[model samples]
Target: MVMEIVCPAGTPAALRAAVRAGAHTVYCGFNDETNARNFPGLNFDRSEMREGVDFAHAHGARVLVAINTFPRAGDQSIWHRAIDDAKLSGADAVILADAGLLDYAARTHPGLRLHLSVQAAAANADIINFYAGTFGVKRVVLPRVLSVPEIAAINAETDVETEVFVFGGLCVMAEGRCSLSSYATGLSPNMNGVCSPASHVKYHDNNGELDAKLGGFTIHRAAKDEPAPYPTLCKGCFSAGGQTGHLFEDPVSLNAEQLIPQLQKAGVRALKIEGRQRSKSYVAQVVRNFRAAVDALEAGRPLPEGMLARLSEGQAMTTGAYKKTWR
Candidate 1:
């Protein structure tokens, strides 16, 4: 079977765009802290989620609700309610990370399909099989840390389907495990879903140069006319090991469209796009292009070239760790 093309939809409008652009699946989150991507002016409320699911189903696409963040010590009910709301909204599945929460859902909502989120970082077959056996997780979103050969090896050892991020953005650290943001700004991708949030960003004129500061830390400093990337701590240039450069990653977006065949050969069941915080138009374009790529692959045709370069951030793209050299 052809791998499913799953796209992110941060808003109702983006959901519609993704469906229209031929996404086989659309993943979104409720407008609450229960989700990892809980940014302002994004995500859907309960009614909007219901309507969005209905619309996507009408268009022959599935909706996956993301309740991927870890629950606070005393606020587990919010995440539980969000999962219930997703089921009521007719979502096809719920992506999750926390082990306790997975156990909770398995016991309470046994009928709903559960996909382990990338945030869980279930990279090896042993851990993935453990989750499957323990919580009945049907699929696992493989973290970006694995190389293609490593992924192939994992597939040979497990029956649970694997999903991979094929395009848009890259996380240098393990997803949902990095606390650098919280350590810096008291907000994090796992806790608050905002990394180097705009609220804490400051740009100053550094003597005819531009300095982008995040949480009082200088992330990027360059000539005023030079393009400055966002102050994401991972992509930030810093003096490390007696050198100053992008220590974690260059300001590049992931563009692994060309690896679809290899991913398929590695036993991936779905390809995920990772730009929930993007615009509706961007979502539509990416969904359309990726849809075309998957369709071509299914038909045994050549893949399209540079269909999304103009849309890439910083006009640069990377294959990420999917290639062995990224390790």
Candidate 2:
């Protein structure tokens, strides 16, 4: 089978744009904290979700609702309702991260298709099989930490489908478990669905330079003519051990377009694009480009070169851990 192109939809408009741009599947979240991209002005309302799913289905595309955040104690109802509403909205599947939520979804909505989110960090075959056997998870979005060889090994051992992120934001830490943002802002990205949320981000003009601060901590400073990156803790520049640089990770997006054939050979079932908080135009352009690439790959044609360089973060892109360059 041709590798599926899974696109992110931050809003109803983006959902439509993705589907119209030839995305085989579009994934999105509810407007509340039930999903990971719970930033203000993004995600779908209940009615908008239903409409978005309906629209995608009408266009022969599938819609997956992402209720991927961990529910707080005594507040499980919100997550439960999100699962129920996703089913009602005709979602093809609901991506879940928390095991409790997965169990709840498996028990409560037996008919609904379940996908394990990358947040679960199911990097090995054993855990992937366990999730498949225990929770009836049909698919698992593998964490970004795996190399292609590791992914192929896992695929060789598991029957569940595997999805891998091929484009967009690069999370340096394990998904759903990074506390750097919470330590800085007191709001858990796993629980609150935001990292370095805009409310806590402030930019100050400092002597012809701009300093980007997150929760009173200076994350990055740029000269007058330079662009200031958003203060996401992991991708921020820091002064540590007398060296000033991106100590944890640089602000670069992942672009695995060049490795599409290798990933297909590695048994990846879907290629995911990770930008739920981006604009509809961005979503459309990315979807069109990826759709063309995958189509060419399936046709045994050479993959396009430098098709997405202009769209990469800071005009810089990395293949991530796929090639194990960090070692």
RMSD for each of the candidates: 1.7, 1.1
Predicted structure 2, TM vs. truth = 0.98
- For model 1, residues 51-97, the per-residue Cα lDDT tens digits are 99999989899999999988989889998998889989999999999
Model 2 regions more than 4 Å off = none
Candidate 2: tens digits of C-alpha lDDT, residues 53-170:
9999999999999999899999999999999999999999999999999999899989999999999999999999999999999999999999999999999999999999999999
What does the lDDT read for residue 149 in candidate 2? Answer: 95
